[model samples]
Target chain A: MVLTWAVIGKMTQRDPLPDGTMRHSRRRVLRVGALLALGGTVPSLTGCEPFNREPPPPDPLAPMVDEALALAAAYRDAATTHPTLASRLTPITEAHAAHAAELARITKVALPSATPTASTPADSDATLTGLRELERAAGESATQACLAAPAERAALLASIAAARASHLEALQ
Target chain B: MNTRTPGARSAHAAALTAEYAAIWAYGPIGVRLTGPAQEAARDAEATHRRRRDTLVLRLTDAGDSLPADQAGYALPFPVTDEPSALRLAVEVEERTAGFWQAAVAATSGAERERALAALVDCAVRATRWRATAGITPLTTPFPGRTA
Candidate 1:
């Protein structure tokens, strides 16, 4: 009877059982299984922690587009005073709106909630003069953008700069 | 004569056409616009004339047939009122601007820059017209062209 029991034990321990045998061996198997399960869960756990990592900031061009749109709005308001001028300018005004909308879309920015408030220059004539000055500055800024970057950027900035120059001429 | 690309020729032609239209539009634009605005309109006309003259000479030098001035060209519409006149001005600038944009597409280096500058000038004029009309969004998405 004892020989039979020993034979049975040997048969059950086919995978080089440790000295601890039965209980200890089972425990080690469970531990290995647990480790494998843990290993499988690791990638997802790291993925979940993505919020903990820092993200890069948005492109600077986004804000510049917004500013350009705002300036365009100001121009639109001023254009309304002279209907003949306004009619002449309708297409141009429409074009600016389209540009502003496109830039806003590109930058994934919402249209600015507030309209630009014009602090009226002391006199109407003075205001026109001031507007012209502002136009010149805007033209310079647009030209600078072209000078500062890649071909695509340069083209876009150049277009804006030209608009500014046109404004300066009209104001004159 | 040096061989020119189709794009280059097209752009050159477009710029020339714009010059023609600008020269034509100024007559009415100058009349309707008064005071400082009138002086500006006259100056702009003179600028266009100079550009037109330059293009004619350049085309002639290049052995290309230059387009002659027409006795009259149709405006987008009648320029009877100030509003109509301003609108015409905008149309003219935008049309010219589109040509420059085409030029930019055709040429490179200095030529491209010049085309770009011309486009900007048209756009700027459009914006001024917008401002004069009290509209918002002075610079249009596409300045001189439909697309």
Candidate 2:
């Protein structure tokens, strides 16, 4: 049978179960339906709780934010160590910071205070090389995260992955 | 291949539409570029076409009817020169990435894997186009998102 948009819209508005328990399959349906309805603007499903439900574990999004911040720090530290590369590196660094902020906002979590670990480059060339390595690693991590992320968060993770991949090319 | 979920099937269909557009946009984008840039556009177009074919097969196997492509698509802007062509390339990739992003939110398992790969591919391509255009900050914080 053909799946019409109207049918999917109805699925998203499903009421909570009588006992206040939701099946995994049904939850997946609701999440997908909501995503389609929002046109990908919905950040996360955290706010979809019906009420009286137990809180979830550490937010899955926390790691993504941490990774983004780490990438930003890497770029910033590299620029500081090699001032000549500052012009080329600074904008991307800020982009990473923006990513971290957005991810934190969507996840409804505070930004972590701990500083990210950064490499100390010996020169401008080394700084570019080191940054390339960092971008590659970050891209891989983001791709893996996208693969495992829930439907609600997969788009964000995929975008992060893609951005990092492009960063790798730019560094070249 | 669980086509039982209407959301997943519909999202996949949407992705197919985006892929169709990407393939068509590349025709104009490639002709305006030359040398290595031209080759890159050709490669990008080939990749989109391959993806579109693969998605068609998967959707068919999942028992969903294929959506028809548009007779023609309106270019976001006129592509009268090299720079404009590159910009269109970037826009096409970003637009397609948005559809795959939506698919990621609407599917699971191997289907989700396909969606994620498509999303990432479009994003990376867009970034490369931005670099070619001498657009600074060669990457966006979020590839498929507007806000």
Candidate 3:
């Protein structure tokens, strides 16, 4: 003979009357099904209630990754027009790429795959001004991240922020 | 090891969402960007694509449901000029950084490490944007910025 245990609740209590016999019910089976359903529900729920759900909020890493990617773009752009800075800029761009990869690893998120158009305004003066302005904004973000997160995160942010500082210097 | 837990998986998914938004923001960003900036934009986009693939595998391996990327995403504003583009770039980084910060709180151990790394990465990128924009006081003091 063969014995198989189906997915059912087992309640072998001492026979209330005399000889020992067990009684089973639908309640246990229902409970297990509910757990499975809830497990599936949470992920979907996150999408529905991105703001309300009391789970840990979204990671701050997204901005950092974006910034890193942006920095790479900026540096790469500078390298083309200002070949003098190409060598100096390339490493910085690479650093940003590395930072983006590291962050993606942590968040388990996909990075974008689209290329930017690099549309500079028609005016050369405007182009220079815009570049300067952009650099400042990038630096500010890194500084804010360094200040806002915990020690480990703060330290990491600070280092990246420092790198940005160097970029700013190079731009000058 | 603990990647299967609700907390851990949520963190991972959040990271992916940020990546999605960053990818979207690049379109407008690249338009105003020029030269090496364009190449960097392309490379960044490729990086996101690769990372996105990695994320899908990790989530699936950990028994998590992966979120699908939208065919089109709405931009916060029109990308008419370089200034607007830079502003949008800042906005994207800040928002995405907040998401990763949330993941850090939601997870633990290796998951936590990844979340923290993501958070750090965002913060760093944000700083770079600020610097490019010539904004002072670049970067957030911490990750998971609320405001």
RMSD of candidate 2 to the truth, in angstroms, is 10.9
State the lDDT at B89 in candidate 2. Answer: 93
Model 1: per-residue Cα lDDT over A68-129, one tens digit each: 66666655665565444454345445545565676676557777777665443335566567
DockQ of each: 0.19, 0.48, 0.03
Write the residue-wise lDDT of candidate 1 on B1-147 in tens digits: 111666666668768987998898889887988887677677777877887887677667767776667767888789987778778877887788877766765666666666677777677767777677666655555455566
Pick by DockQ: which candidate is best?
2
In TM-score terms, which candidate is top? Answer: 2
Write down the RMSD of candidate 3 (Cα, Å): 19.2
Candidate with better DockQ, 2 vs 3: 2
Candidate 3 lDDT score at position A119: 49
Superposed Cα deviation of residue A42, candidate 3 (Å):
40
lDDT, residue B6, model 1: 62
Q: Once model 1 is optimally superposed onto the true structure by TM-score, how far is the C-alpha of residue A11 displaced, in angstroms?
A: 64
Candidate 3 local lDDT, B37-99, one digit each (tens) = 567566666766666677788999877888878876888889887777767776776677677
lDDT of each: 0.63, 0.80, 0.61
User: Using TM-score as the measure, what is the rank order of every candidate, best first?
Assistant: 2, 1, 3
For model 3, the DockQ equals: 0.03
| Candidate 1 C-alpha error for residue A19, in Å | 46
Quote the lDDT for B47 in model 1: 70
* Residue A14 lDDT (model 2): 49
